[model samples]
Target: MTDLSLYIHIPFCQRKCPYCDFNTYAGCEADYSRFIRALNQDILYEGHTRHHPRVPTLFLGGGTPTILKREQLDIIFEAVDHGFALLPHAEISSEANPGAVDQSRFETLRRLGVNRLSMGVQSFDEDELQFLGRIHSTGDAIRAMTLARKVGFENINLDLMFGMPQQTPAIFQHTLLRAIDLAPEHLSLYNLVVESGTPLATWVAKGQVSEPDPDLAADLYELACELLQQAGYHHYEISNWARGPLQYDGLPHYACHHNLVYWRNQSYLGLGPGAHSSVEPHRWSAVRPVGAYIKSVEEGVSARGYEERISKELAMAETMMLGLRLVEVGVDRQMFQKRFGLDAVDAYADELSSLQDRELVSIDAKRLRLTPRAKLLGNEVFAAFLPE
Candidate 1:
């Protein structure tokens, strides 16, 4: 049977960050309770068959899942337990903003079966935090980390961003050093992608803000990789690094199990407004508007706004693109032939030859993977998967 995962989206935030473009709203507490009820209803309506049992990984992602009160979280967790068959050792993770948590709250969540905590501590610099419109001060982030440790959180991940506006190498290095001192189990380091309609994008359009230079950003990325590597963190994926053995060993090694479902083209059900899901050939998403989602759910209806059945060729291309993100799960020669009925090496012979010639990829007897130098240019490598 194909392994499954669950993603529960909480779209409420205390305050929206200037750079964030996620589908989130402020002051939606009244609707939240009803939303949770509707979520449970929808889960039961979909029916939990033995063929596709409850997920092993339950990821509560958000605009800040920690924004929910302890009681609210309890209700959601209870519903999840009732609606699905949770594995005893399931990895239940919740994304938290630094300002949204405390020792007591962390303890409460721990008792509620949240085994992992992924904190959003984008940067350690006070000015950088302000620039990013984060709600918490740098001190609050540090305190949150300390408190998580004190509250007995064994698995913690820190989310950090680089390549922000006016970010200098020295400043980034300082942030890196501070992060290392904290020594979280996992780190997600991503470059800032300024989406249109965000405040940062507006500032850029008005000549008030400029992103860090590409060359400088590249330098910072390389430095981060080197520093994290020396700190005993494995650069497993392009952006994720972790210490020690794979936490979810039974699941995929490099890709986090929950996200791997997406990359590996497996089916999942997404709950909450603006949540996306792919169940086999079809892809669908709930209405992005919070009000509309609540209304539909109250009316005992699914809040679906869009749906599409992906073509076989498109799915195959996506598999290659997403699979290559991991350092270990390479393009297997025989597996590709079995799945797609085509030899990946022969099908994309020209592109493979070019990438190999450029030292971007290494091909052995059975598999193909990115070279260390090429991982930095992962986008360029993935672009080769696009149809010619």
Candidate 2:
């Protein structure tokens, strides 16, 4: 089996954000000990069952992974090391909240072999921060990153949210400038997305708060592109930038390796409630409820809520769609041919031609990629390859 990335979901949160719709929950403090046990069991189960697949990267994501105490986090790492053999230079990343974290917290993280820190700073504007329901203030974010550096975290990524209500070009620019000034190794600039079932969606439905302006969102995205490029950051992927010209495996040295596994349509294993896994051909998601996931694992049953085997045609279409997200490094034509026995050019000739006619994509002997215009209308370009 191919070496795969590991995504471990930590579902506890200090409090739920109104605009958030992830599988995380609040008031689960009581379930923490139990869930931690179950999580480790789930990890062991996969390792034993899969004969200890080699792990290239591990991403600890959640409502707030930083919410856990250092000791709890330590045990989780021990479980991982025992269950799976992580490559020595593996990218071990953990998402952290900027609030309520002291220098000691980051030191513990380093001791646990978490080399990369992804801080969810969200926004620098206090009003926007309040609206987003983030636990940290702008000052808190800065302090956390500074402390992280003090404790020797060299690979750091700051996550910022843009396109909020009442946000303007000037306001978003300040946030970008501040983030750039910090000089983190990586940055993820994401637009606010209002998923259904979230309070933000309900607010939009009731007209309590106006919907996020698409035009404004696009403008902010453009502004970020310009500002980041000038600041010496490589626009590696949509919504992600990293200080580069530095190379890791011939890609951006600071680019998220775990996410690259997904972008490249490679195999991965997701452990914990509400996590999804794709081992090519087969894909599955663990059940969402904490108790249910714990019980299933305790009883030695698969915690999967649903599973499916995707068709090759569908997988090809998906490969094209996901590959284009890497703004700088689009799909590799030769690699595609090696994997599927058909060059992407020939496999989707008609679709490629149609997209080219629309000036949304460009294809060449070595690679196939979206045009600059297509970067803004990526969904439109991606939709062309759907298995219909």
Best by TM-score: 2
RMSD to native for every prediction? Answer: 2.4, 1.1
* TM-score of each prediction: 0.93, 0.98
Cα lDDT, model 1, residue 251: 22
Off by over 4 Å in 2: 246-250
Per-residue lDDT over 1-388 for candidate 2, one digit per residue giving the tens place of the 0 to 100 score = 6797999999988989899999999988999989999998889879888888899999999978888888789889998888898999999999999985788788888999999999999888999999998888999999998899999999999999989988999999999999989999999988898899999999999999899999999999999999999999888888789886657435678899999999999999999999999998899999999999999999988899999998999889889999999887789988888889988988988989999999988887778888888889999888888987
Alpha-carbon local distance difference test for all models: 0.81, 0.90
Worst 10 residues of 2 by lDDT: 243-252
**Error in Å for residue 221 of model 2:** 0.5
- lDDT per residue (tens digit) for residues 126-156 in model 1: 9999999899998999999999999888888
Colliding residue pairs in candidate 2: none
